[model samples]
Target: MWISRAGWSVLNMLQLIFTLAWTAGLIGVAFVVLLVTRQRRLPLRMAARCWVPGLLWGSGAKLVVRGVDRVDWTRPHVVVANHQSMMDICVLFRAIPVPLQFLLKQELSRLPLVGAYAKAMGMIFVERSSAREATKRMREAAQLVKAGATLCVFPEGTRSHDGEVLPFKSGAFQIALDSGADVVPVAIEGSGKVLSLGGLFRVRPGTITVTIGAPLRTVEIADRQLLAAQARESVVALKREAA
Candidate 1:
């Protein structure tokens, strides 16, 4: 079901239209919910639940999730996963059962409707322009985790080009340490084949598998790097298990 570049344009444009219209409609619902409930980011989790089914249908990617019982969703968690495609975002939202928040880099926060959705969801946007700004955002994220919020982060920082899991970054592990939350490594396969990095227009229908690993407990600062390495290893292992 892979689409040629020329053949993808019309469908891409149509997807764009659906995305914008759907996002706008959801934003309106989020606004009213916010106005009444006054709960920050409740709108985000709500919107995420609504966004997943559409993306899966539009991409023609059937989802197969595994290891749900591996970690307890009742408690807060720092969920880290490998990034291969933008569809991974929606996939995670669908895979995880709880209301989740994300760690958005500065650039994604400025996307027209997407940014507004993140803002409404009360997602933290990290500014990489300077160490100070990034630290500020990380601190906020840590605080959120400490308050029992489930935050999803792609520790590789960005999507991989060839579906390989990239090297892990320290920020997510640090957040786990700072917040005393367990780190959950999740592996996603087949999403890259569905919608690849910079291959937004060339979508194909396929099955995407999500495997969640056991939670890694946060010990102390001395284990930060070790924890990150272990998380990466777990992700790789989970990817194999999923495959």
Candidate 2:
């Protein structure tokens, strides 16, 4: 939160420019690929490939991942992580090379250009205010996973302002249990410094690590609540290891 005005301005300009350029290029590539193969997974793969430069453009920020092989890409996986900043999504997008569909907020689906792209990417948006609608959306997310689509969910539900992990929602873990997909705990470190939640334009460029943990099969767990707690603990442990 204590960034110099000059540094904040420069960071903001760079983020804006990179976002526009990346979006344009990725969308163009997606259009061409859709025309050729018409395969849904191709666009997601292309998006991941396209995000590498933007992730690197964040000045000094870098990712040091651990337990990368623990991730089983052979089937759908539920990647759960703590929320810290908007940059966390970008970092994970570039770091994890899987065809992922984010369990995003419904409000994000209303954003101008980004929303359109997010929707096209098969991102599941839940209406947080409506419990019934939220449950329905979670069910849809489970169905997506059953369809062999990897789902990424920020269990904290929102970015934490204090750079500390918050309480996680059980929806994601529950979906994994119901869908029989493996739950992968991911810890994203130092992203809060890159873009703090409380700060407006104040940004600090630094390394951000994303450590992936071993996959936990939800079917082995009889209770969903226990599974969620265990998944949360795994992420916290990974964060500590990264620290």
Candidate 3:
């Protein structure tokens, strides 16, 4: 016997609640470990490798990743991706093997435990309203990349409501150019079906395909906007390929 759409929605909501609880518990433990050891690497890695993947599994999302081997694990990269859903974060964390620091909105820095963990992990927070502050934060982020931390940024700045790749923001490209790091373009498809923007507690079991495009060379690119455009094009192409 098959379940009705309403029944399936109820089941999905229950699954999402369970996943959120499990993830919150893990983050709490990770925060404690960060405080005890004064070492953020292990806990951050655990979040990427374990917690994120667990969230996907618990939500019944099958992740298919391609071109992961193409990523140079030894060097820091400006990881740029088209944002679709909140699940895009989980997919990126699970697929990328190297340690990653997110370039998040400054508002996220105010959350209690989660914010504390993010700060400890050296995540870059930008106050977009202030141009000077944003530039300062971007410079700091570039330095972090130079210091061997891959910086992941959703250049779209917000989740796409219609699954279309939005125009790229220049901040991520600027960071890559300033740090002399390559820009790795990533395409995340099918996540919008799982948990789209404005869906809140709504989620569904589905497959997410992550396509990692070839790293764009920043050394030869003199224009940050051009680089951003190129990265967007790569993501758009990869999205088509995923389709």
Candidate 4:
């Protein structure tokens, strides 16, 4: 079950360094974007492109996605998925070829270069510990959707220690309600085993599947609890399918 921990650590460190360089590269791109257009979507396509090799070669993680065709890429949508590890973000970043706005924790905005990159990438950050702050962030996410941006939410709120699906947070569903955005349930498998919560600087070289489920309509759910339940059910079904 254990991959080469020492070798993985070295590779992981290299990824971290590369991410720093990538961040710097993005800053340059952002500057160019400002000079080129009024749109703030400069990091959309490039981020996804840069993310490919960053996870594939940087960590030896290959990706396989299913149900991607089920989605209407031309229209805007919200993506809901499980959070198993930090590697999950990198995997999704690469596999998703579209412009994505991530709903991330506010603390992540504190990271030096990564934070800057996240901002440039149009990530929506929330203060999880504060209900008010979290609400404001959700509203901001809604606005992003209104502006024709696709958002990704890890409804589990945090990474699960065991592979079992945890309770879905209502915030993601709530945003769907406010934004009138379709929810695309995504299931990410094998990432948890690759880089567990046990420690950082860990990786397992193998295929990681990011399966997108059929879009769930927000208006169909009458309540928050129901919305959360449906989101969880979608993720559970996705996991089973991935299994």
Score every model by TM-score.
Answer: 0.92, 0.90, 0.93, 0.89
Q: What is the C-alpha RMSD of each candidate to the true structure, in Å?
A: 2.0, 2.4, 1.7, 2.4
Model 2 worst lDDT run, 10 consecutive residues: 51-60
TM-score of 2: 0.90
Candidate 1 clashes between residue pairs 3 or more apart in a chain or in different chains:
none
- Give lDDT for model 1: 0.84
Cα distance off (Å), candidate 4, residue 236: 0.9
Candidate 2 residue lDDT tens string, 189-238: 99888766664544566888899998878878857778878888998899
lDDT tens string, model 4, 1-243?
554757667767877687567667766776577558856565566666764565567656677888888888787788889988887887777766577879999999999777876786678999988989888989999988877888898888889988788999786777888888888888999888767677655556677898888988877875878888888898899999988
The global C-alpha lDDT for each of the candidates, from Candidate 1 onward, is 0.84, 0.80, 0.87, 0.79
Off by over 4 Å in 2: 1-4
Q: How many steric overlaps are in each model, in order?
A: 0, 0, 0, 0
Could you give the candidate ranking by lDDT, starting with the highest? 3, 1, 2, 4
Native RMSD of candidate 1 (Å): 2.0
Candidate 1, residues 1-243, lDDT tens digits: the string is 566777787887787777667767877888888889988557766755776787777777899999999999999999999998888888898899888889988999889877976887768898877889898898999999999899999999888988888999886677888899999999999998987656446677799999999999886434878998999999999998887
* Cα distance off (Å), candidate 2, residue 133: 0.9
By TM-score, the better pick of 2 and 4 is 2
Least well predicted 10-residue stretch by lDDT in candidate 3? 196-205
Q: How many times do residue backbones clash in model 1?
A: 0
lDDT of 3 at 142: 92
